[model samples]
Target: MTDQPPTLPTSMRAGRILGPGHTVVVDVPVPTPGPGDVLIEVARAGICGTDLHILDGDYELARFPMTPGHEFAGVVVALGEGVRRSALGQRVTADPNLPCGLCPECQRGRANQCHDLAVVGVTRDGAFAPYVVVPERVVVPIGELSFAAGALVEPLACVVWGLERVRVRAGDHALVFGAGPMGCLLIQALKASGAARVAVVDLAPSRLALARSLGADLAVTPDELAALADVAPLGFELVVEATGVPSVLEGAVEHARPGGTVWVFGVAAGDAMARISPYTLFRRDLALMGTFAVNQTVPQAVALIQGGAVDVEPLVSHVLPIDAFAEGLRLAAHDPTRMKIQFSFGDASS
Candidate 1:
């Protein structure tokens, strides 16, 4: 398709307005890519918890009336002038957060902390629509990978970034709290990083079961952890709190072995507080840290998926058509049995 192809519809269908407001199918403009940008025909878009927050206006940095889907895979249909990095009909997934390379954080090699970060689906329009415009630098080619798997690169990259911060070592025992999409991805990453045994905890039996299929050595419901006390009496060497629940954070601290690190990757709601013993933190030498969105780990995440080190297929529980966007979001929000729900633009068989 050329830049000046037939005049497309001015508005397209999308699932929008997440948290306080109900997300319904709405008509939105088909965006245009400016200079140094490329227009993508979104093939598949993944639903994340962040989208739920956006609906509620709970996201601190989000703007209203926005389409809220960041994780996506699409094909390039048009390129703005001076954009030479990408061509038409290329299959790719984009880094949702586009950082300015000349910013202070970028100069310091911490582009993730850039002051001028433009995140798709949050501050700007995103892939929930039929078309999205993004910087050429943000798109990464996926070669022959399926569009569904390509959409997962965003969360996988975030997991990779969190793993980098934790500095996992071989033979370490890891306990991941929450067997959601992020939790499952972390379990796979931990195993690939040489962790001896990775245990996953979640309330959902289906999610726990999927975690097992994704390489978790031990998968248990939150209520079942008491039974495994005989197997891991001293707790695990590393604790990852992937569930944003306050009680889960406290449990991570309580279940961690002395001197073990705790990595908090989930986005706990604003004003939500967790009570912890300062004495325990001081005397036990426990490390408590939080990891935000991904930085520069997209390439590494791609390499892991491309090399077959991580299997993302089992995590994709549902695939809905773009017209059913509202139904997809509702199913993702209310259904405990669902793990990951994706929206597709073209044929489902594709």
Candidate 2:
């Protein structure tokens, strides 16, 4: 990144998700930056559950043999036609969502809710390569932000959106089920946004321990809820079920205080169903809110990471080379210790 290189090779090394249970590393054409686009030299890319879904062909919009990566940070290498900015050598991160401008949702300024939404990593080539072409509008400057923290902005943006619909008052007691990467981020985000204390529940002790290390007021297994009656005798004011499991979704409402809000923020299977009593919902006057991905929260997410308000550093447990991206997938699937496994495309590190 020292000297601004005039040009790069025609082809570059990249990781491609061929189909269900298939991945390959190969040399592919560096995508041509289109009008109002910027070519990025990928520094790091993070692996998440959605990546697996895309790889397994579970995402309806995903096509076969695609370079799969959504969360990434990089340096601007070149600018496309109609782009007047001097983006070369600038560090940056971008939102992966591509909402159709013609959609009603987009017209209403709710692009995340667009009916014809197309995600970069899911429906098109992403940053798990030496270079990727992204629209200039989605790109956000990562001033003094490390590539590792910058890559986390995408997920943090989603967390910000989750809280946008759910109320988080000062001194509010919160309970979060599922201490995975998103869950952990939710914990920090809640604290930063003014929640008094957060009790985390997860099946794994390691994840719970991480929750505690990250300033969670309480970290306990789901089975230990009975023992925590004295701590939140009435139940939490805010209940978030981060695990996409339907069973967890069904039972999470029970952990919310009467009239308290419940945020169903996880991505459950399209066909998945969680039974909640309509009678109870009416009787308790409880509010059940559903939040989708990030919408206009990228800048705040970037600020949070760069300002050290949310630490995703601990979440990145594995930092492997781009050549081992396939192996990174295996670890993401099987490794419980792995909170976030990222591919280092160049000099990127954990």
- What Cα-based lDDT does every candidate model obtain? 0.84, 0.85
Residues 1-350, candidate 2: write the lDDT tens digits: 22225567789889998888889999998777888888898888999788877776677778888998999999898888788764788899899998888989999989998899888787889988989888888899989887888888899999998887786989888888888889899999999989888888898899999999998989898788885566678888899988888899788888788878889887776678989988877888788999988888899999888778799888877888889988999988777667878888866442
Q: Which residue pairs overlap in candidate 2's backbone?
A: none
**Candidate 2: lDDT of 42?**
89
The numbered model that scores best in TM-score is: 2
What is the TM-score of each predicted model, taking all chains together? Answer: 0.94, 0.95
How good is model 1 by TM-score? 0.94
Q: How do the residues 1-350 of candidate 1 rate in per-residue lDDT, one tens digit apiece?
A: 33634555667887777446666677777777788899888888999998877776788768876787899988888888789889888988899998888989989988888888879999888988778888998889988888888989999999988888888889888999989889999999999998888998988888988898888888998778884455467777789999889989997887777888888888788879998888888888899988888888887888899999998877898988777877887887788778889988854225
lDDT of 1: 0.84
At residue 70, candidate 2 shows an lDDT of 91
| TM-score of model 2 vs. true structure | 0.95
